[model samples]
Target: MVFSWRKRKPRNGDKKVHNMELEIPRHFICPIALDLMKDPVTLSSGITYDRESIEKWLEDGNFTCPVTNQVLRSFDQIPNHSLRKMIQDWCVENRSHGIERIPTPRIPVSSAEVSEILFSITDSRRRLDRCGCLDSVHKIKKWGLESERNRRCVVANGAAGVIAAAFDAFAGDSFEKNAHAHLLEEMLCVMYWMFPLAQEAQIYLGSQASLRCMVWFLKSKDISVKQNSITVLKELLCCDQQYGEHLAAIDGVNRILFKFIKNPISPSITKASLMVIFHTVSSSNEKTKAEFVEMGLVSLLLESIIESEKSYCERALGVIDKLLETKQGREFATDNALSMPVLVKKILRISELATEYSVSAIWKLSKYEERVLMEALQVGAFQKLLLLIQVGCSDETKEKATELLKLLNPYRPGLECIDSLDFKDIKRSF
Candidate 1:
């Protein structure tokens, strides 16, 4: 209800008593809100307001009461429990009106409570007792669910770093198939809750043991565990390109990443895996990029772009552009059955970023090989490039489109669709 304030006598700071237009009692309403107060708390100035409303007032750097305009001696607000009970009773009496009862407010989690919980997590991690780890982490999950503040509290207390230390210990023997995997999943779930992690958390996650930990988790048959692992790895790789490069260099790590994309667990997981792929290729040496291509990443990339949701599709385009940077990558794309059509299909149909990456991928393909220009034309790359230029795109992408048009426009179609020819095809031809 809107309050129309007329000048009032000296009371609290300009207390605007409710403009009695409604059928509600003035004392039943918060003075500041001019409406029924849920969870009323009396300030030092003898003014009561909805806790949320006053908290916001305080948060806005206002030290004075909205009603009294009197400066607060202290910011403490005492819960007006009597007023709350009266409000609840009134709401029940007026249930026929549209009034719904406000549920009892939860006391927000405190730093001390969070500290005790973190201590339990630390103790549980150190001991490696599955039952203890489960109990502690369950408490954390409960605390986190109570409010965003609790999540911040958990992160502030280095929950992620502690979990990473636990994960690191588990990685040393992840292949043993013990209770560590289940406990690791619990730890990972909690850590994943606080992504864009605190610095202390990132420090532990960026270590070598965490890399090995990630590799083992990717092999997890449990989809939830694997998805969480992929997502966390995606962020970690982004933080340090070296992490991506290092992961790519690890034994069978690239294979696991490639395999994740190949199998297609979920859209989010797929996009994350694509990012991990792009980061690894972009940050690594030429040999590392080539090794990924040789391991059959290019075909899966094409499949991803084709089958993907918007997120996966965009990431797949980025990986493709990164892949074409190396000779091995280019050769694989040129020979892959889906490369030409996938590049052509994405040019105008996807988002601008997708168009940019698609144009760049095609440019790398046709620019280097020149012979691939024939295949691009046959797959209608020439027409897509022409459309892209005429409409809109980034300046660099537009320029590449123009260049490809200049090259492919001169080429006639049906110049032998050799894009599908792999090493076996070439061997047969020879």
Candidate 2:
């Protein structure tokens, strides 16, 4: 593909300079990518492709070579350092043609490297060197933060066990110090990156001491630390059912969660708090749900339903509906000043899920308390229920709406009650 052109006379450095405009050779390109290889490597089939392309091919569950179509026995790729050097040299020679030199790829971290880090943390903890242990934990956290490959390497080599053990051991009086709080943050944050924990790690982290460490952080004055604590708790519990029940068994977990939800540090914290409650509030009997009902969860839920957007509101309403399954919840709702008003206000006004929960809560109230049937009439529930049917909703919701209308039909006001409805405190959650 060379173009015929004139050759000028040799300059003073002609012997030192053999540079000329050259076309790219076919072999210099990756066969799979059909482009120049930035990180060329040789596959088991003796064919070459860019490292990223081959990794993607193997990750997609393909076992055969893309070019040779041969079954692959090993997926390891040896770096084609020789060919990479040739391409780099060619780019340097053709610098005047806008070719940039590609930098060498980094060496991937391995499980062996992470095992050494785990040893340092274990040794530091054994020697009672809190400062040294903190430093080792910081190193592991930094590496995990660098890349997903580094995180996998760290977690695969048992970083979770050592870090969680150290964190649990710090539950003594020293846990009160501000300095130790920072150490706790570093330790817990690393646990977050290693999701889908190994069975052994899950068992160790599910211990009472480990659970206490995170619950303490949930009460930290720092908003970020509070958020991190809740986030880690959610992930740790969500990983296994036994872990969730253990945390729920803690005496003050719900109280702290409800308070956090009431005066949330941020919307994410509020949402996470709701999720923790959602995951933990049930215990196969009515007493557990009753405890939450008596603990002001119902009031907080009504507030969330009014202040939050679609998803959070729907979640809040769902928790409320769950709470109503108990006699205590129904009595509390009928007693609370804002329960019926707030629940009725959300009907036909928010998301379909939210509307469903709201209608269902009111229906439950009407079914047991009997007084809610009139409370519904006062808040313009009858008109909203009728309009809901007209606009259409889930068949279940429509049936409930129909029955609710039937309950209030004799008392249906002669005039529209839209003006009397109050949505005065609706706040933006997103």
Candidate 3:
């Protein structure tokens, strides 16, 4: 890796240099490149780095100082003139040792430049220039990745709306099959990078058309698009609870959600999709619950309960608890093969919250349906309930278990109650 810059004989009055090797000063080396820094800049974390190396790091979507592993409070990188001078001096001294002096690096784009890009993209009168503006938007997205300040600038300049418009434009009339699908994905990626977006901006971009476009993104073959689409929708849903109903009403929401459940692309995607469903159902009426039942959510929950990890199981159980508020949900749970066993298996096994949810589901079923009661008895639910009472459980869990036991006690074998019309009057005579 070493290169000879020059070869010269020893000069007069110079001490004989025994070491022929050239070694870079430790302070001059960039943490990223492990070479002499060309343009040294100090971050808010009190770490100094090469401007080009740090800029590239930020562009790659990293938000922390690489050397110290500290989350940077400010994205600004101030030029370290002292360090730069020292490095330059070291380079000059080593010139005879074949060391090359580093050149200055380019400065990053300014917020004003990003602002101009966003304005052009949003200004429709310049129709011919929109494409070029979108290209600028892509550049701004790159800049945003470099630092939080740039990210805030992107949002402040209405990048959210611009990205939404890009989504709608490139989605085309046929939408999913649009030729500009890559542009659509790029827009989504930018939006995700600018996450925790302003509420007003989220509301602005949460238009009906935008909702539909995001739903379409869920069905995309591209996994990144799908992840970003769900993430954006989840964030938008957080902006306003009313949007949950609007999202649920959108076509293919249920189908796509079910698809995510049936064939998960990743744990994160599955969790987000489930959250959307949970949010939608939370704002909905009985009809929505029935629709969820018709979409086979019950079966999906049962499968998820058995196969998924603790967190997924907890979420599935929570959603099932909501769905079981309706007759259809109760029927689905009572009839499914894995429903009872999985419910019984998870009780007292995963987490306190999970145990509470499982007990609640079983309590709902056993209270109304005799068949479910018998099924519960056969599956050792009664024993588990008694055990739940004896062992430590939450107050709510103990109350539910006690109620379930009371309901089942009457149905216990040889414990049938007789008509007692005259018993009050007969008293001791009986």
Candidate 4:
């Protein structure tokens, strides 16, 4: 039963034998690929498949047999060398039938190779060995995606330090100017795959040079690089509170982050940038509020709330409320043309946190910028406030809304004090 896999037309003058068809044996076909087994390997479930197919399946977080639908005892893929040889022999014997012999696959990277690359990366004298180190790092990153074992090998061999060095070398005079930008983007790609790294790795990657490189990537023409950089920053900066000011002082950091709020490539990217901003403003003071105002963060956040998801709007509103704690933040929100309308719209519209922050922002504006009170009322905010009172809210939101309503129209004849309202029977009309 010789297996056949290809075809050629019979000669015109040949006898009926010339048109005879060659048939393929069913056993030679891989169950997963439905084709002749090239590099055949058997799983614990005793089913054979092409090695690449089964390895990919296991690495994708699957723990069961694709064929038997049973829980796999182990993920080990033992090479079916005898079956592969038989398939190869069949191809050889059927050469006249147009079957092509399959070539052997390359062996995947081993822990030894990864360790060698790790040593090459950290050796101070090897700074001039940039291309080779980068190629090695790139290969490890490729192999890391192939299996859980390879990922562990790559990380155990100090992948974090190598990536950090790669970025640092990019900033220094290691690569030529033309190729420098190219490698910087590549380094970021590697970082993207290695997210949520070990705490020690995060500290090593938080070097001043690495920090600057990541901030620079926020403006990258490649959206992927920008997103990866922001994610990396969030992972590193959020882990340690002491690095907050260091991130804040990076040139163009605030401006670039604010820009992402208005021109985000995706919700995830915007969320990442917002998280970085939140970390940067953790312990911020009046000077920090003024800096954000100068960078137009207030307007960007106000605009963000209009179309962002619930979580995004909540974060933006929370940041805005924090900014309002300072005089500069209040003035910026009051003066921006769309800020009042956007903030007022968020009241009783989005999530509870958004409504809380929106009411707080309005309270601050009414308290400090007395001139903007009527504008808040004109945007239907008074109705939302009445709704807040009618339906009820958190004790704090209820108190703040009560204060704001008094400031808006002090002498309303029928208005009830927040303390006297019974929340259980309250109705929300609007």
Candidate 5:
């Protein structure tokens, strides 16, 4: 059959279209596919070809442009100059309306399925020991498209595996001290995907299995896994109220968490530990609070306020605020000499950070102790409060600061020059 040739249409920005004829011998033509070019374009390397079929030809290596004979080593090496410019123009034109790309739905695979896929890849105790599976795991963890559904699935499966593995190891007496440690490390590497899982699992599994896993992981010498384990437990405790009761019942759980809160090497771990303490305190019954107080968690929290890290200080302050809401907690705060002064200072210091949560805690603490309100005024915390107002405080901070200001007015005589400053002066001073 004879083929008919037609001149190609000119592109929008085309200055000129060459009418050059092809002079190549018929035998030298690419015999694999000789279809006419669908979208012919020129590359930066002075090559002219169809973009669609060039990608496949690239794998054979050293494929020169049929017309220009310009050497091209890889598909990436051939720059689509006109296409790039067109994309730039399109982006600029659509900048006002904004391009809306459709989101892909995430498939939720269960833990059993993931385990099966992983086991199918390798029978080794280490999931990543297989050649191709490690890469796949890395991609799933790092590069998988994100959504609430996918996030939940990843977290659930990961947490289930981690909890199951740790429980099996501990219960079956199959804990290979060294090998198990490596497995834990591998699991932690994919922890971001597993966090949502642990959170959901906490709702159904309660605290026993998850808490056991956390304790074992925390005790491990590996700092990475220990950090991740603390993070996972903190997430679970924060998300599920059901975990609170069982979490406090675990032997040495409070003490272990206390150690991390007091002196964790990782800031993230310390923050997580402090969050766990807050959840533990808030969700615990009177007996659990008593047990926490007996374990010196209150004192540990107090000391954390003076910690060199700002996050520790913030978390410590949060725990103290939660504790103050309860009668036993208020008693715990008052009985401890260092608690009031340290908390007042943190309230004022943390006001600079000025988050709604931080300010709410400060407001709650101020309500508990008239002495703390008086102490705050004595330390010119009112000035900080005034500054917060002037610099545009959040609704919570403004409300709390205003209430604390009103409370401080009752103890105004004790405050230095409290009467001298008017509201206008206070506003101007900041």
Candidate 6:
């Protein structure tokens, strides 16, 4: 008997197309190798087609199902083994062709690429600004960021390059209305972001131009510009020894800072000025230190140390340390009757306030072999030193105390008085 193909139908109220009792022939089954259909194209009731899978089978030259020997026109059909081998060989040949060199189509640079580059540069600048990384500024210098052609004036250019160009452009040109306000703002921003860049760049570019711009900004009506200007000025001077002389000679720089120290309107401005003084005094050469003393900086710094706002006290103390480094400075302090007792008392107060730097400065000042130590001891500075040593807050204070003790003869009549006081007997009497 000949087998006949029969179409299956759903019975009444039956949702399934194939009856439960009758097993569907495996030949009519869709190959599990094919993934679930995304865009299924129907072929017939017993068969459904996936265009890609059918195309693959056709490409393989297999027209029959291996299971049922049925011609494969739809998804239900599977290819015979021999035909599959032929398709595999063809695929291998096509893959080999693909592996061989083929010219890829050239594509033009898209707007997206330009936008990405711009965003990358801007983002990098912002990150560098936030992080205050000096190296990132250098990297930006080496790797120039893409700039918009016509809109170059609108957007600020290279991080450091912008400042360099602006300084060059505005060189010898008095502050003019024609100058790009945005560029000026960007220059200030760059200074604010990485101050060392502008400072170092100033060495290559002369100091006059940068100094002029900074001075102008310092006097600007805008408070932020003034603050940033002071910050830049401080950084510029703080960069290295080469800029020191130029900084000291700059008109209004010292006067303006002294004025701020005398009466500051803003805390930030006051702090910046103190920092400028601290760095200037701390890092100056002997000649510069003498110049500072000649300018009455020593008096102002000492005054600031004693009576300025609490914020400036530490910096003022640092300045004192630097000032005391010179014989001239020691004589000045001594002539002013800044006795060891006075200094030790001040240090003790500072230490009580937890100002370690002040303590350290005092410790350093106490190290001067000839005058400071002798004068300090003459005024009963040892009592305060012993007080600090007893408290034991710092190794330095202890060491200084020990050294100062060794320098004095405990058997000396005056020294014997302190040694004679017995703490236990005094406590018992009390």
TM-score of every candidate relative to the true structure: 0.76, 0.71, 0.67, 0.64, 0.54, 0.48
When sorted by TM-score, best at the front, the candidate numbers are: 1, 2, 3, 4, 5, 6
Prediction-by-prediction clash tally: 4, 0, 1, 0, 3, 1
Candidate achieving higher TM-score, 3 or 4:
3
- Lowest summed lDDT across 10 adjacent residues in model 4 is found at 415-424
Off by over 4 Å in 2: 1-36, 82-103, 115-136, 153-166, 169-182, 240-255, 284-297, 325-332, 335-338, 341-356, 375-430
Q: What is the C-alpha RMSD of each candidate to the true structure, in Å?
A: 10.3, 7.9, 12.1, 8.3, 15.0, 21.4
Q: For candidate 3, write residues 192-293 as lDDT tens digits.
A: 876676665566557776688788878878898899999888777766667888887886787888889888899899988877777777777788778889
Give the per-residue lDDT of model 4 (tens digit) for 1-430: 3343434455575344443457767888877777788888888999998877887788799899889989999877788888888988888988767778886655556667887777766663256555765676677668866766567657666677666765665555533354566666666777676756666566655667667777877777888878888888877766775566777777777878877877768888988877777767765556766788777788878876788778888888877887888788887888888877788777766777788988988898888865677677666666678878777789999999998887888533343233232233444323
lDDT values, one for every candidate:
0.76, 0.76, 0.75, 0.73, 0.57, 0.51
Segments in model 4 whose C-alpha atoms lie over 4 Å from true places: 1-40, 43-76, 81-113, 124-128, 144-158, 165-184, 217-227, 259-272, 308-315, 351-353, 369-430
Candidate 2 C-alpha lDDT tens digits along 1-430: 3212223434454544344555677888877777778889898899999887887798789999999899998988899999999989987886655577877776566667778778888787666577888888877877866666677678778777777777766644366565467777887777877766666666766788778777878877888788878887776666765576678777787789888777767888988888777666543357667778888899868765667678788778878888898899998888988887798888867778888889998888888866677778877888678777777789999999898888877765653254443434433221
Per-residue error at 417 for model 1, in Å? 15
TM-score, predicted candidate 6 vs. hidden true structure: 0.48
Give the clashing residue pairs of candidate 6, or none. 340-376
Which candidate number maximizes TM-score? 1
Q: How close is candidate 3 to the true structure, as a TM-score?
A: 0.67
The digit string of per-residue lDDT tens for model 5 on 1-430 reads 1223333444566666445332322322223345323333455555555444564565456467655667755444343445444434543554333322222222334456656554533443233343344444554454235444444544444544543343333322334334344444454455544545543345433545446656777887888888877777677776775576677887788788878865667778878888887788778877766766666777767765665456666567667676666666666766676764465445434534524444565577677767777656665557656766777766767888888778877776746443343333432211
Judging by TM-score, tell me the better candidate of 5 and 6.
5
For TM-score, candidate 1 versus 2, the one ahead is 1
Determine which window of 10 residues in candidate 2 has minimal summed lDDT. Answer: 1-10
Q: How close is candidate 2 to the true structure, as a TM-score?
A: 0.71
